[model samples]
Target: MLIDLHKATLLVIDVQDKLVPAMADPQGILARIRWLLQVATELGLPTVISEQYPKGLGATATALTDAAPQAIVVEKLQFSCVAAECLPESLLAHEQVVVCGMETHVCVLQTVLELLALGKEVFVVEDAVASRTPASREAGLRRMRDAGAQVVNREMVVFECLRGASHPRFRHISKTFLVGEQP
Candidate 1:
């Protein structure tokens, strides 16, 4: 089944102020992730954001921080979101999860695997997740795919959420993500 927007969430993991500028492709990753968040919001989907040790790593980026002011920010030390007591409460298991954000080999990969093991389907937006090195990012994606998680592009997710162009929120969500063509 495709990702139903009514039962989907956009999970932003560790896209923090300090961590972002250090990424190999900061602007590109952030742009795609922000697009994901915007489209999710436009479609009335829920969002869960995580901060990997905020006291040390700092807060989420200003743009993301403002994207959904109502979104809960989980300050976590664990690599997986379910491992964080307060965080899992937000996931709710209501539907599929579309994951993105930093440190592909660390928190993002770990969280995706854990979610999949829980029998929850996860879609990782490839270009939005990054690592300190290209090799690390590639390795992380390979491992996640092997674990049964679907690593797809941001546009694939946008269409799955849209389902059909006739949907009421189609144009709004589509334009927000800059989703060009359907697959």
Candidate 2:
């Protein structure tokens, strides 16, 4: 199913300052997530940032916060945002969720599972998530897909949201964000 911008919320899970340096392709993943956040903002989509125990992991990356300054930030101890019960009502009010973050095998995977269980349509942005090792990242992506979450890339999410070139933001988005991207 296409990701309906009106019904979807972007959930950035634990892309914290301390945790990011330990992930594989940390900079690349952050770039993708940052791009997604910027596009989400331009499209006027709601976004939620989840930090796992900020005292330890630190807060969401500075770049991400700057990209979507209006995003709601939630702090949690549980790997799964649902289990932590820390998700704000604003996030829960959405029917579909587009997710990206660090440590794909742990927090990202767990959150995807629980969100799926809750009957929410979950989309895991593969290129926007990673673990310290490539193996773990692959495992996490496989598990998430096996569990029924749609596995997609950042560009896919953006295009799905735009739906078509006729969309008012399409040309601007293409020139601003999709210029160098490959289908």
Candidate 3:
């Protein structure tokens, strides 16, 4: 199913400062997430950021927080963000959730499952989520897909939201974000 921008919320899961360095392709993951955040902000989509155990794992990365200063940051010890009780009412009202974050096999996977179980249409940004090992990341993506989560990339989510080149934000988003990158 195509993601509806109007009914969608962006859920940025556990991309903490302390945990990022060890993740596979940290720079690439962060760049995709930052780009996603920029697009979400421009589109005025509500965003919820989940931090897993801040005291032990540290806060969300500065770059991510800076990218979307207005995003709601929710601290949680639960692997599944749903259990954190941190999702904002505005975001919870949305029917579709676009998720991007770290450790695909653990936090991200569990969160996607929970979101799906909640009857929300879940989309996992494959490129934006990562694990320390390629195997784990692949397994997580596979399992999420098997569990009915749509596995998508950053460009797919952006362009799908835009729908057409004639869209007002299309030119700006394409020129600024999609430039030098293939969808």
Candidate 4:
């Protein structure tokens, strides 16, 4: 199924400063997420960011904060963001949710599951999320897929949201964010 850009919202889950270094390929994950956030901004999509527990986990990484300055940042102790009741009604109104963040096995996995249960067409950006162990990350991806979330990569989302090369922002987004990157 195609992700309808008009009905989509981006959910940036728990990419906290203290937690990022422990994840596999921290830099690469952050880069993809930043690129996704940039595309979301250019497309005028609303973004909701969640911090697992700022007091303990640290704030959202500076890179992400700079990338999505206008994103609604919610701090919560719940692993599943839905359970935190932090997502604004405006964001929840969107039928499609694209999730990207840290600890794929924990926060990302739970959030995707709950979003799916809520009837939202959820897409997890695989390359934009990571876990400290490859085993956990793979398991989380499998579980999310088994539970009904469409597992996608960042590039697929970017182009899908753009729809076609003829889109007005297509050239700009491609050049600025997707350059030298393979899908």
RMSD of each: 2.6, 1.5, 1.4, 1.3
Error of 3 at 177 (Å): 0.8
Candidate 4, residue 83: lDDT: 89
Q: Summarize candidate 1's per-residue lDDT along 12-89 as a digit string, tens digits.
A: 999998998888888877777776677677777788899988898899997887777767788888877777754655
Score each candidate by Cα lDDT.
Answer: 0.81, 0.92, 0.90, 0.90
Best lDDT goes to which candidate?
2
Off by over 4 Å in 3: 181-183
lDDT of model 1 at position 32 = 70
Candidate 4 lDDT over 35-54, as tens digits, reads 78878988988999999989
Better of 1 and 4 by lDDT: 4
Give the CA lDDT, 0 to 100, for residue 42 in model 1: 74
TM-score of 1: 0.91
User: Which residue pairs clash within candidate 2?
Assistant: none
What's the number of clashes in each of the models? Answer: 0, 0, 0, 0
Clashing pairs in 3: none
Q: What is the TM-score of each candidate against the true structure?
A: 0.91, 0.96, 0.96, 0.96
